[model samples]
Target: MNTSSTPTPESTSRLSEPVAGAPLVLPVIEEHAVVGREMVETGRVHLTKTVEEHEEALNFTLLHDEVQVERVPVNQYVADGATLPGVRYEGDTMVIPVVREVVVKRMLVVEELHITKHQVPTQESHRVVLRQESVQVTREPAPGTIIPPTASTPAS
Candidate 1:
């Protein structure tokens, strides 16, 4: 329970009006201002990608396949009833096609491809390359007042 004192009429009149002879001591009241901060959008950030090509020497390992073809002299010819293989591709290697006809069997035959994969790990240097996207920072002041860096950096 809250108990409060109610001022009577005489006490109210005395508080409002000062005495005539004696010096009156009035209480002085002061009001202070309150400052607050608010968040607002200042500017927008736009990101764009641009591709630029340049020739520069760089040392790195690249993944690729290289096919080496060696022609061996085949003096011996196939037999009359021998069948030849067909042409095909193995990985990055392609085989040349060669057709043959069997005399006795009367069957068609083609050449086959023997593919050998070789991975040669090498170090190479590339030229200067331009990046597509970059980071940029921009600062914008508020509408009413531009707060100084020192003021804004301080703790609230």
Candidate 2:
């Protein structure tokens, strides 16, 4: 009595023994859930700018360090134990040695000091009044906002 609806181990042991009711075929199941939506990127936003320009050519230079003192007199007589004439350099001129013990007590190199150093570079030209600074970066739109012009923002 196998009519082929695919249950054959003696019809699954006679449908697992339930013949007292003679009309029991229990199996009923249902589940439904179908939802769909797509657009997920999560991150992107960046804008930055920095600009500065200045041009200046103004010249003024002054340097004067002048020192020149000259006094010369030499009664020149030193020979009785003579190894005394120190301090002498004559490229930028500095020669200082002055000694006197005369009236018959030998040692007279009387008064000799010539010190000279001079450098004077002076160019004074005055005409300068400078104050110039300009900077503007603006993107203000959020009251019925609409901004559509770029190449450094030019649309009145």
Root-mean-square deviation per candidate: 13.4, 13.5
lDDT of each: 0.58, 0.75
List of clashing residue pairs for candidate 2: none
The 10-residue segment of model 2 with minimum total lDDT is 41-50
Q: How far is candidate 2 from the true structure (C-alpha RMSD, Å)?
A: 13.5
TM-scores of the models, in the order given = 0.30, 0.30
Q: How many backbone clashes does candidate 1 have?
A: 12
lDDT of 1 by residue, 10-103 (tens): 6656355666898888778899999999987665555554565655666789777776764433333455555554456767666654445456
Weakest 10 consecutive residues, lDDT, candidate 1? 70-79
